[model samples]
Target: MIGIDMKLETLVNNGPAVIFLCRAETGWPVETVTANIVRFGYSPEDFISGGLRYADIIYPADLEIAVSKFSAYVEKDYRGKDPDCKVEYGEYKGEAGGHKRNAKGNLGKGRGGYDSFTQQYRFLNKSGNVLWVEAEIKVLEEEEGKACLFQVTVFDISRWKHTEKTMPSALDTENELKRIINSGHVIVFLWRAEPGWPVDFVSENISELGYTPEDFTSGSIFYTDIIHPDDLDNVRAEVSKNTEGGRDYFSKEYRILAKSGEVRYVDERTLIRRNEKGEITCYQGILLDITQRKKAEVAQRLNASRLEALVKLDQMAGASLKEITDFAREEAVRLTGSKLGYLAFMDAYESTLVMHSWSDSAMEECSIEDKQFIYPVKSMGLWGEAVRQRKPIITNDYPAPNLLKKGYPKNHVHLIRHLNIPVFDGKRIVAVAGVGNKEENYDESDVRQLTLLMQGMWQLIQRKQLEEALRTYSGELSRANEELRSVNMMKTEFVEEMRFPERAEYGEIMDYETLYAIDSQQQKAVNTFIHYSEKLRRLVDSLLYQSLEKAGKIDYSFEGMQLKDVLSDAFLNNVFLIGEKALEVEKEVPASLPEIRGDREKLTALFTALVDHAIKFTPQGGKLALEVKEGADNVHIVIADSGKGISKELIPYLFDRLYQVNDSVTRRYQGLESGLYICKNIVDAHKGEIWFESEEGLGNLMHVKLPK
Candidate 1:
């Protein structure tokens, strides 16, 4: 009453219900409770203080049941059996899983989606007395995929319950009349059976239709005047029968015009009231509002249309982003009844706008030069306002000077009623969509439909991006796999070369050495030739063995073999060299070391390499020790020697192929520096490790671990 600014708040506060908003977590703590809470004999401060919670006021016996039901309801799983609360008979026809037409006939989607539910519970009030209250709750906010707040409207229903219990059986008709007259859902009236059907009495709830009972009784307005003109004849004819005694009662559904110029549907029931003389005196009637039910039917038709459009969009899978954007533009124009629509893409920082797609009824085209000037934010227009404010902008008078500070280009079409909505990627407005020149003013419903269509298109774009990435990764993986296969094939060829043919060649060289020995004149050159040929043969054998190990082509068999036996055999194989050097050999080989699953041939070769390396580097009479021990899951073998140990600078590269620590001209070794590298490969093939620690002048300790 004070000003239009406060009118809405005043009206809601004076309304017949208490409205509240609260957190969605356990116990539903109150965030804001409206002034109307005083109707329940409690101050709004009490709830807002945070000391009291919604669950605390609920009757103790019903608290648990209420919390459970509320949770299920908010989660969209509580399909109650009450006829009025269940999904309507035919509403679920083609709905999807986790989604159904709710009681209000709206298609409910994910958890805590659009839904309405009615609940009745007892509340303990400030007066220390219990009151029966009926509450209507709806999900008001959902954040991070969880319900975060709810809007609740509550009303005291104690009087209605009390009336039902005390009414007598014999006076049922009188009680029924009184109940109907006082009911909030209906308006009861008594009208004199006259020309205008003047009201003699009317229910207090006639004000709900935006008119007072006093207005009808003051003679300035009559009951017939409020009836919609289209429905006046039907209503008059139905009521005449009851008044004229053609029938004692009559019922009809008709439209009524309210004081605010809004048409509402109502079902009317009338009965003629007469004295014992058998003449009609007045008409007794009740009008129940059915406007909400009628509106739901209209919404059902709209939803069906929206569903068809959604299916058509979904069928465009694998479409390019531009194609999807174009389709969305067309749909936006069609649904909102706009004459033209355009999509503008924003740069990463939202600093630039580029017109990406256009749907124009005028079939207008922009020259390449003119397109550059289109809707730049710095120009300061409706389109620019959307980017600057990061919100939607709608203007019926789009051509107004103040709204469009920088006017449109000469070639641009005239915009008479415009709507612009920002398209968001998370919190950033990645694009702005504009539609213009609708015959009627654009409303919130138009914006909602267009925004939903855009969201679906965004999902399609994201899917396309993910699929492209997967294809790229798959191609890279395939190329890498092919390269590995090529390397394995080359190894196979080398392994074949090292087979019977190469060994036979070595045997022929030995035969030549024998021939040279028999010829005494050439005996001097025999040692040199033998040394060169044998070293060449060893190089070829090491290369072939290491290659086979790398390609996983080493055909070694696994069996339970003792570590001590393997080491003993390796030591025995090297007995001649050890005896020639007169090395101090110490054996700590356990007689019964743990048996490991390994290839006997490969294990023997691995230890042989270690022992050979030690003897080659050790000076004569140097100490050599072989030790074997059992471990948690492996057999440990240590071969140590006091040799002219490797230099610190060269130790890291000892296991590298063709890497010689000493100069080739003055080297003491007979073969290439691939021995240690070959040794490492052999150990690795058996799933074992080989490494050595050495000091330049002291000794070297080589450790081997073979898993059991």
Candidate 2:
């Protein structure tokens, strides 16, 4: 490059050198400049004398054409000609030889290659021989400052040109290979036979595989050392299957454990063969990844499982109610690995889920309507949205950020995942189920499971509710019959008692106290039997009247009622046992617990049962306290006692019929276990919940949360 630039300067400074431009059209310089030609040589001079007409000069033969092109460009205006024009130049071999040097050759001590100050066109002289010389010129500049012609400064460039032919060194070749491999191709490896057979190095471009020659020192290395354990078996099996007489040509998938312990799976293609001497020769291969392919397979399975779940939901249509409900949850949990689940059916009023269940050790017996375990539909929550839209929804984690930002409680965050699904009976959502805390959180599996769960629930809940209604009615009748029989026996026995004579010494201790004990025993039997009958009779009456009123056959509203007046009637109906147990009562009504729409007979049955329960459980000296508190649209009625407190376990099942304490002989309470169940049934019928808190030896506090 230095020689070329210096040569340009030399041409410009040389004394009077002829210079001309080559033109494609006219083919010669009209006027030209020159100096002596002897030094530069006529051969090279004649090469530049004419301009291009294309046969050859520097092109090896057409010397006169180059001269013609130069003279034509010098004379033409070229003002509006094409901006892109071609220029041709030439210099002869003999004249150029003076400036040439061997770049790869040793020079004399303290000496460096000389620079060329000039170069010219290579052309054939008048003698028809190639020659070289210098030339220079400048073109006129336009007002726009664009040059119409190029300035030409020519000198011999043969010496510099000679250096371009020398071969590149070994270092250059290695660097070139490095560049190629860095572009991301090239596989390298080493293998041995019998764990040590002078390492056979393999590389697509072996010399560029990057290890220096010193790396091969000592003994050959075993390739098996780099195979990851999990992939080693594959590698070995593949190699063995294709190997015979210590030779194999095979392909297999295996993982290579890099120095950093990252195992990269690779598809290795090998080429192996034995030499004629029966000696093993080569094990070679290329490696590629197939991880994405594996992921695609998993995705395919997930899609199939999802489709299967959808089909099952359709097949089970109109199936047994219990079977369908059960199948729904089974498939749901299986799909999502959900630890807890529920399915609920909303009541006609669309106010609540009348039937519900979930999977929770802490709440096995709790209802979906229970506040501690289920979301409420009217509560402006995920549950509300699920039902309102009649769709399936999933919450990967609870204490939902958007819901929380909109005012949900933070305690729910610990609940992990949550899902809410609606079951549409028709145009409206009549059922719902919220499965929570998915083992794998919400994913395609979960969405699929929930879809089927909801679909199944929608079909069964609609008809199942009708079946439950008939069962409830049948149970009510059986209870009524039993109570009526006991009531008749009591009436007969009371009359029989009236006719009995006081014997001389049936009990020598014939005093008022003793007399009271006898009367207590008899009164208990009479009161219990009578009270039970009356309550059952009233329940039957309510059921009958409500049915009629619902069908528009009766007017159910009362004339007017006072809260205390209603309670007093309820208290009177159960007073028969009050005297028998000798229990003391405390009543406090502050007007907060308002009287609301309800049947007098139903409240009577509710009150009578509660009072009966208090008396049966109280110790002789204990008392039952009845209290009330008012809220805006509802009331709270509390019945508390100083009796032995209920066990934590028993309290939860208090309202379940036939649930009696097996240790009753030790605890010593009277009455069948159905008393609380009756009380709970009445309260529930009135849109209320009977809640209680108790601990052994501390006493019990019962709360009847009633909606006004």
lDDT of 1 by residue, 1-708 (tens): 558759667756765568888888778999988787776678888889987888888889878767766766666545544442222111234453334554655454345333467777788887878887788776666554456777778877776557566756644697676665665678988999789999988887888888887898888798989899988998887776555533446789888888976779898887766665546788888898998787677457656766777777887887777778888888888777788988876643455677777785634643334455244567655568888988778787776668455676676777788888887754556578888888656777777877877777765654454345345445544554555555555545644555365447665534565444345433323433443443445555675764676697878788888777778888888787688689999988766676788888877877777797898779978999887788888877889999878767556556654333333211212223336766776688788888788998898999988898
TM-score of 2: 0.31
How well is each residue in 461-537 modelled by candidate 2, as lDDT tens digits?
Answer: 43343334344545655565565566566556654665435674545533567456556655555555565555455
TM-score of each: 0.31, 0.31
Pairs clashing within candidate 1 = none
Off by over 4 Å in 2: 1-223, 226-231, 245-281, 284-582, 590-592, 595-617, 620-622, 632-634, 646-698, 704-708
The C-alpha RMSD of each candidate to the native structure, in angstroms, is 30.1, 24.3
Q: In model 2, what lDDT does residue 237 have? A: 71
lDDT of each: 0.70, 0.52
